[model samples]
Target chain A: MTAVTLSEARPARLRVDGRLGQFALLVPALALVTIFFALPAIYMLRMSFNAHEGGQSYSEAWTFANYLRLLTEPIYLFSLGKTFLLALVTAAVTVVFAYIFALYLWLQRGWHKLVFLAIALCPLLISEISIIFGWWMFFPNNGVLSITLLQLGLIEDKISLMYTVFAAIVGLTYISLPFGIFILLSIFDGIDRRVLEAASDLGAPPLKTFAEVLFPLTRSGIVVAFSQAFVWTIGTYATPIALGPDSLWTIGLEIYQQMNTWRDWPFASALAMVLILLVLGSMALTRRLTGRDVTHHV
Target chain B: MVWPFSQSDLFRWLHAALVTLIVLFIAVPVAVTAVMSFNDASLIRFPIRAWSLRWYLDFFSSSQWTQALRNSLEIAAYTTLVSTVFGTIAAYAFTRLRFPLKGAFYFLVMLPLFMPGIVLGLGIAIAFGGVELFGLQLYGGKALVVVAHCLWAMPLTFMVMEATFKTFDERLVEAAYDLGGGPVRTFFEVTLPMVSTGVISGALFSFVISLNEFVMALFLTTRDTQTLPVLMWLSLRSAGTPRLAVAAVVLAAAVFLSLVLVMLWYARHVRKLR
Candidate 1:
């Protein structure tokens, strides 16, 4: 009778352990990611090693010609460098402005604070296409900027600000600003409210307080925001294509054109593989610098 | 709250000035879009020549616009369904189970969150471009677009749901089990209802993001299966008109409606919890 009861209990215990239930629950998601994301990425890496045969096909012979060309080609190398630099500048501008906005939001009170937070979240929710075109319309000659300036008699004539590196930078900053602010706002919220008061009581001036207290305390958050912004800006293609001058070519656009127009699948995949590496490298570097996993922060 | 240097008048003035500038910087473009959508003049200009609903009607009437909108809606729907369900399941498994290579699995799962859409798009297109099921090509298909968007949507859903589960009370599940409820019944009657808020929020976020996403869709889809953002992008590259402004407003309307739904759901759910 005791042996029989123990046998019954063993099955019940195994069921209660939930290993089976966990397996059943996790398979669908694991399979989905494996079949789609992981497989595609692996296939892309493999394809990058194959030779592209004009138009619609690839040769079976494996080669590193695609990557070699990427290194040897002056245009491709220049675009990659340009993308990194543009990302850096865009991140700096976004982090600076967003820090100010987040600080204000953190200190404010009541309805206005609610409104400011909601408004700050707008760009984040809006489609990238909408934001690009919104700025597209705003920067041109008949745009609100020029018209308002003209009406105010600040400028004598209309000037189209479209198709400039400055315009592209502004649009990129617009898209990245809200994200940076949200990340920084959460960090700022973590600080004690009295920290600022304590700093002031210690006789530090406003600028000095910001430099010595706020900036230092939130340094990791600042780095996280900057790196997040930089990584994000690198991936985005539409803003630069629509608003940037012809001279301001980036690797994203290069990849798109190669895949779509040139139909060079091998080259495009090679470029994409390089981009993935760059992103991973930067994320690792930032993680080392901040000594934190920022996967959640952004 | 007082500023750190509340005693300094110049500092106060400058801070206010900076806030104002930042507000204007964000607000101006959205204001411009809303304002331009109403322009009677065919061109996308400011200082409203006349107010009209002409472009709104055009957006609804034009096949290019309507087809794109339909495609976006369909893809977003699938993405929302797939991501919310799978993401919830995966999140649960990650939180509850002591799996092998758990840390490595998590890092791999979340890696795509930072990946560029173009890279993901190109990779997917190359990998599955030649494949077919039932003689239907996988490339340029709406289903393919849905899966691509899922790459973006699912990880986000997973993150949110996992965070929510971290705060969840597991004793309730045990209590339900002790009362003789089976696994299935306990999941539905106890676990699900308890986590409905996270599920809803995750679903809403995925739906909205998939709706807005276009870069991947561009690479994965043909003209027939193109999404709104992809169409808008193609046009923006060549020549653009006030019609684009109308598209922007319409797309924004979809996002706003979803936002309202999520807000209402949260309000009702929070009250019930209280």
Candidate 2:
């Protein structure tokens, strides 16, 4: 509430000449979005209805075969279900870790805050591929995880967790953690720190205080964070493809496969469309349910 | 104590333990990668038998790797320039100008940032691939990737600058106008100086996004135009080598170096402003 509202600060000008100039300023952005984002999206949607030929990537005939296959075939159906489950689990786990981390950050002051913030930023600043490479180093039979366990005498022999569902989840959660922490931290900053002190002075147990005081206050933010993380995790293909077993298929990998392996452009577009819908639908539902624009939280 | 948990030694110790684990979860992988980058051996093995900068030398010497590096930098540079300029102006318009369907425009501009790279890549590739404009192929080129990157970059820049401009005091802009400064002069002299940090950070985000991004580039780039991350992804799939580790370190170094330089410049700029 302390933040300045735009309308209060910028009174509308009565002059029409400046209006024209202001409108002109938006032309470049509008043009870029229209030419790149809007047109390609529309084209992809159209491409989804086109016919697929084995020899060519796609043909110019109209058909619903792509959608028909996506809806009916057990393979595509299974991948869709898997993608949703993966995203949900990833988001849930990420939110828990991020909540704890954000609470820890909230309690800290001075240099400790800077240190933890820098640590939180590690995943964000590094490339996704590098994070995958790092884990790629960690999970192999001869990898860091195996070697460390061996040295600690915790395991009889080296074992590889690479290309497993667990490894995939670990990678997914690691990348999504920073985003969840950031969103939750912003919400935490808005709460009065003295509320916790008051609760402690009143003889409330820590668990009871958190359940009654903090949980209810941050419920909306947690929902926003979960939905945001879900939206991001659902669209990603690389981590799962790089880390997971082939049996662990998701819609993103399906899209990549359809485009790259099969060269089935129509099928790929159809899958991409479904993924887009899932993302936008989750975002819309979050906004509606919370009555909060989640975008600004980050 | 500000926190209830601070009153309990048991709770405080438990909290510290959990937070330490979380930090390690975030930090250890990066540490491992940085350490492994110097392995004298080609294979990744712990307790290095030997240590040298052999992989770094290979990364710099190989024509393929160097070409990818150049491509990554070129695309990122163009992406940074295009997105920052377009996004900054659009943010200004949102705050300062009156326009119709403003809310719709704002949503439209931000929508792309929410989209996954896979979908955007496929959409752009299919739509623009194999197409030519003015005797030039639009697909398989750095220009196309720059535009593709702007889909996410411009929106991100807009978001950052939008927040920046909202916090901005419009009175200074009015004062400039009252003092007979035109919109251009006022923007250059008065408005931009105030938001330089926001603009710089936005540009940095754009650059980093384009540099690290691969899914979109994977679809759009030919072997000739492959960026470093795309090259890394391809090379990683083919073989495991310390060279990949070196590439990871090199990429991180690029991002961190820029981040440090920006921080230093930001400090100097703030002092100057003061």
Sliding window of 10 residues with minimal summed lDDT for model 1 chain B: B103-112
Which candidate has the highest DockQ of all?
Answer: 2
Docking class of 2: medium
Model 2 Cα lDDT, one tens digit per residue, B1-274: 3665766888878888999899889987798899999899878787688999998999999999989989998999999999999999989988986657987898888888888999889888888887999999988989999998999999999999999999999999888876878889999999999999999999999999999999899989999999999999998889879999889888888888889989999999989978
The lDDT values for all models are 0.87, 0.89
lDDT (Cα, 0-100) at A28 in candidate 2: 97
**Candidate 2 regions with alpha-carbon error over 4 angstroms:** A1-14
lDDT of residue A172 for candidate 2 = 93
> How do the residues A169-275 of candidate 2 rate in per-residue lDDT, one tens digit apiece?
99999988999999999889899999998888888888888899999889888999999889889988889988998888888888888888999998899898898
- Alpha carbon lDDT of residue A287, candidate 2? 89
